[model samples]
Target: MLRSLWEYRHFILASIRAELKGRFARSRLGGLWFLLNPLAQTLIFSIVLSQVLQARLPDTEVKAAYPIYLLSGLAAWTLFSEILNRSTTIFIEQASVIKKIAFPRLCLPVIVWGSALTGHVLLIAAILFVFLFFGHVPGWSVLALPLGITLISALAFGLGIILGVLNVFVRDIGQIVAIVLQLWFWLTPIVYPASIVPERFRWAVDLNPMAPLVRIYQDALLFGHWPQPLTLAVPALVAAGAVTFAFVLFRRASPELVDAL
Candidate 1:
């Protein structure tokens, strides 16, 4: 396993570069779109829901400036969702390379996830700049941002690989994934603070696996608080389990992928 990964390290790097170039090469704004996309969504949501529409939090913990809180959570959720959404078609879209080249098939999904993450990282920087401009300095807990994002990437990649392989044989899997992620976006606490969730329904939100990760971003960036060790522990374990399961399924499905395509 280690040898295969080591051998493909160069290919993975190249793939990441290729993905980035492919995204921005023809664009006038180029990589600036990465920051613009998320910022636009944040502004629209803030205006429609927070300002014009007058949305309110169910719990007292959330402050009047809910837009910042919501944006922080959405930033993480968007990354996770983008990875899974794009990864579904990765194997199909790259079938030519898979058939013509003799590289690690796993690199396809990895590159997709990496590119999606790159955009998210850019958005994070934008978020930080906005905070700093507003006189909000993230505390030491901001260090946890990378770890939180890593966990999100792990979960997204694992699911992506599983779905990417499945999508080769079942075209419907891609459409289903789109629907699922849309529903999942609402199920998560991206628009509201987790504290607003009633106690009984809170577990349902926590069980989402993405919830704890969103909270990690919110706490670190917005509230300048460290995520409790136990809070991260549970989600970390879940992400590990997800990766293990997805890898096993991906491997089992890989050999048949070419045949299906």
Candidate 2:
């Protein structure tokens, strides 16, 4: 699959460009919509919840700490959700192309990644600018951002592709996933800090795979702290396992999947 994707790299890149262009073609703002959507969500959350949670933040020095915290974690969540959501529907969305084109099916997800990453990169730059504006520049720990992104992307894409494949056989799976993602977002502690979770419910955070990854983002981007090596353990393991499993499932299902599409 890796080699297949590589062999058709040009097609994947072109698809990515075309997908992005088509997404914003009719809109005047075009690419700015990517930055605006997430930023707007951050603004609403900051307005409604910041004062309630800001004082509870571990470090009090940074100006607009809550928004910074919110956006930092949100950057990871947005990248993740974008890929996962798109992966769930990529095959179905490109059903016509899949029927006509003889190219690698794996290229579909790669195109999803490429187009989503384009928006994510823009969001990251906006986030960094927000960090600087508030006098809270990240230190060398910022280097970990890419690793953080890699793990989150792998986990989302891996799990999402399987769900995407299953979604073909059971169309209800897509609807279920959409509802689950909404619940999953609140469960992961994006708008608030994990520390604030009630004691008895704290186990939920420990069990939640995304909890650790989001903390890595907050610590690295908002606090300028290196992620503890221990923190990467669960997400890394889960991501690796998910990817391996997804590839196996996708390979087995591809033939039937085309017919389903």
lDDT of 2 by residue, 191-226 (tens): 888878999989888888898898888888878888
Which portions of model 1 miss their true places by more than 4 Å? 56-64, 198-200
**What is the TM-score of candidate 1?**
0.91
TM-score of each candidate structure, all chains considered together: 0.91, 0.95
What lDDT, from 0 to 1, does candidate 1 have? 0.81
Per-residue CA lDDT of model 1 for 1-261, tens digit only, reads: 447767888888887888789888879999888777777887888889888878766533535356667768888988898888888898899888888887768777777877888778888888888776656767898899999899999888878877887888889999999898988888788886676679988878977888889989988877778888887788788778878988898778778887788
C-alpha lDDT of candidate 2 relative to the true structure: 0.86
Task: List, in order, the clash count of every candidate structure.
Answer: 0, 0
Model 1, residue pairs in steric clash: none
